[model samples]
Target: MSNGVDRTILTKEHASGTVDRDTDLETVLRNAGRLSPRDALRYLTPLISVLEGLHTSGQSHGSLSLDLLRVTKGDDGAPRLRLLKGRPRKPTLQDASPKAALAGRMLLYSSPEQIQGAEACEFDDMYALGHMAYTLLVGEPYWIEEVDRLGFMALCNSIIGGAPEPPSVRAMRRKSIRLPHDFDAWFVLITTRKHPDHFRDITDAGIALTSVLSNPDIRELSRSVQFKFNPNILESPSSAVPAAPENLRFTAVFTIVASISLAIAIVMLLRWTNAQESPKRDPSLQSTDGAPATSNPSSR
Candidate 1:
């Protein structure tokens, strides 16, 4: 923090992840197999959105090191990541490089341009973002054989001159955790092979390459088993409900039943009324043996 109001770049109240990096990354590394490309996109696209905004505005964050980015629980208890602007790194003399006194973020996340002391441009930030992204998804940075051994000049040379393995391959090489099926190939295809013809336009023209994952080729690889989200983790939508309250609905049913009962009762009442209103049966006119009422008159 600059301790001055004018220089504050980050929003307030975020927790650092240094202590929690291993623990937080543990889940991602272990569940890499079950992780879906969509979820990955969700977790990462926001950071890209921020970077895109900065790059579009002709600004660049020189230090996008893993150590500076923090992950904390948000208001809703969902994990949120925030990046703090870090100072540019300068190589220490160490009786070797041009400038060694100044220090910044870790070199693991630094771009070749940054390593060589080139102007801190937006692409350099992108390179760092990509490295961080690879680490987040696969649990490690891309492999460079002499990463630790080759100090300063040699390290910078290798980083610039040699290509690193695809993130999936490096993750697989670690063999510490189970990986998603076909994830290695799918990762390579999307990140490296996809939309080959137009890749340069986004980079060379200084256009903000918002998201590489938006490529259709990358989406195609998602249909493969490895990138699929587990069905078990998918929360079922709440069951559809009637617009009316249950009590009201039940009352409606009860009213209908009562109406039917009342109708039946009314029909019975009508029948009884008709019977009472009708003339009395001619009991005196007809005999039990079908004889005329002449015998009944004498009896009367």
Candidate 2:
């Protein structure tokens, strides 16, 4: 579908009905009833794993956007969702925001000696999770209304420089959406610490996260999913594949052309040789020319 198309974002027509800024959050919540809190957690858990994986690899979802998220109902009547944001060559909706731009400057220009391995990666995941939490609680995508690219970056740098805010804080500030009382605790539980509360270390963190998904409530809800494939994987089928030697395709074409030409030459040589061969004359038969004088009438 992306055949040379520079598609950065896409939206779907509302299946249930039209939604607007004035639409009551309650109505949206009612429609979203199909997905329960447990279901939402199911989706979020795997997503946490995905984010962790991205962080470990020294990558971030450069193009994180609402379209990258998906929601579906599970067999148990709980609604689950899938979040798939791949690192992209083009700026994602967030990258266009002022927050992303400022964050980039501070990351690139600031003194590097103070930063250590995994710090940037962790911070990147932290902010990304913040955005994710905001979307989850709001039951829709969240974006800053303005597009001051530099200002956004600055905002991100400010957040990263100071204590990270709970999802509740961001929600209240950005969209005036308040979250459950436990919201802060949950946010801290998921994003702040290197390990989730249950896990003592990375290995335990992984196991604990996996165990949470196994919870019946979470399992029922994390069904509907969406994501963009990483562009790096799209480049070629295999990583070990070396770039084709210079002009390899061209060389192949030339080889085929030469073979065809050689075949034509051989065919022409055979035709010419046949043309040069002469038919033998029959001596017993009388010739029409004057040189055949010994010709006699056949004995009757």
Say which candidate scores most in TM-score: 1
The residue ranges of model 1 lying beyond 4 angstroms of the native Cα positions read 1-39, 90-105, 143-145, 176-300
Error of 1 at 237 (Å): 52
Clashes of 2: 11
lDDT tens digits, residue span 1-300, model 2: 122111112222233433332233224344773233444444445555565666667665543433445444445554443444433233222453435543453332111111222323344444444445445556643333222333554434333343334445545755566565544443344344442241232333334333442342343211321211112111222222334556887898899999999999999999988777633345545367736556357843
Which residue pairs show backbone clashes in model 1? Answer: 33-180, 91-99, 91-100, 92-100, 93-100
lDDT for every model?
0.48, 0.41
Q: Once model 1 is optimally superposed onto the true structure by TM-score, how far is the C-alpha of residue 147 displaced, in angstroms?
A: 2.4
TM-scores for every predicted model: 0.47, 0.34
Worst 10 residues of 1 by lDDT: 227-236
